[model samples]
Target: MAARIEIEGDRCIGAAQCVLSADKLFDQDEDGFVVVLNGEPDGEDLEDARTAAMICPSQSITVVED
Candidate 1:
């Protein structure tokens, strides 16, 4: 199965680390909160997702895999 990225909007502080780490997989909304560009990411994008989750200060991003 593919990896799925999940963001807890309430936990996001609009740091945008996700965007900086993985622009292809994540983006910021008008309010500066996290907006998922691709919920399911693969290949290099999946690696970026993991990086984003690790770098997120607020720990709002989660990558679930099976």
Candidate 2:
């Protein structure tokens, strides 16, 4: 399955947990909020991306199967 990661800017609180959990997939913006560096991460990185999304405190990260 192909996975896509999306971040809800409105819900993000600059916790940086997503980036901390999965740096390859997530990056911190000037405001410290998370941004999806590579929306589509592959192989083992994909699992980490999903884990980051699932662990987000703000529930701002979303992972979709395509």
Question: Which candidate achieves the best lDDT against the true structure?
Answer: 1
The residue-by-residue lDDT of candidate 2 on 11-57, one tens digit each, is 99988888888888888888887878899888988989888988899
RMSD of each: 0.7, 0.8
* lDDT for residue 40 in candidate 1, whole number 0-100: 94
TM-score of each: 0.96, 0.92
Model 2 worst lDDT window (10 residues) = 28-37
Q: Compared with the true structure, what per-residue lDDT tens digits does model 1 show for residues 1-66?
A: 578998889999999999999999988989999999899999999999999999999999999998
Clashes of 1: 0
Global lDDT scores for all candidate models? 0.94, 0.87
